[model samples]
Target: MGSVDLIASLNARGPTSGFTDVPDNDESLPDDFQREKAKLFNPLKVGAFNLRHRIVHAALGRSRSAFATESPLAAEYFRQRTTPGSLVISQATSEIVRTSVLNIRKAAENEGRDQNHIKIIASSTTIVAATDEEAFKKRGEYLSYVD
Candidate 1:
């Protein structure tokens, strides 16, 4: 079925459909809120990655590492925040961090779970400007502060 059809089907099933809790007063929803909610809660396919929802949990530096390595507690921190059909972005730059993520994935797989539902994305940042001149200017400004 198409996206609209799927949403309609979901909505028709009411709150107990297991997708999401449909509010009883759905008719009172604003048009913009309904549109945004549809996009936010719907499954998204970007390139080869199929996301269950558009909600993205970006990783923040928690200063949980010691000696430039991820601590065991980091794994627990990640585990606590992870939910089925959710994406997690890890900004860890250490090999230990990568290993922890792999271990988590393996454990989930061994339990006969849908491993695809748990997505771990290694995060990075890039600065972009509207024009080449603006980008070049920004780069120069940034470079001036470097020793």
Candidate 2:
């Protein structure tokens, strides 16, 4: 049914509808108490990956690595946040590679459980310039290495 129709049907049910056993507008509990209790904490299939929880932890770039490769510290950092069933989004520079992804995944694996349960997403940002010349200049500056 449409949203309006659904709302009308819900409203028609009044405080106690057959839809749920919990009381409607019960002041005894907090606003979200019933809703939170009803939520499923079970594993769910998201696309091809099975997540343990619905919570997602997005990693912020902290300048942990100076090279294109994922540093040991970065791997451990990402792994520590990979709670069961939760997704971890790791932010890195443009030079992120396959090994970095694998390292993060490996670190997230827990004992007696498959490592694939914890999903890891790698994200990067691209620099944009107003003009072609500016873009090239920016790219050149980014690619240049200083020792």
Best by TM-score: 1
**Per-prediction TM-score:** 0.37, 0.36
Question: Which RMSD values do the candidates have, in order?
Answer: 11.4, 14.1
Candidate 2: which pairs clash?
A: 52-85, 53-85
Whole-model lDDT, model 1: 0.62
lDDT of 2 by residue, 17-62 (tens): 4334434443233344443343343467898889854545556435
Q: Global lDDT of each model?
A: 0.62, 0.55
Worst 10 residues of 2 by lDDT: 7-16
Runs in model 2 deviating more than 4 A are 1-31, 35-43, 64-76, 98-130, 133-147
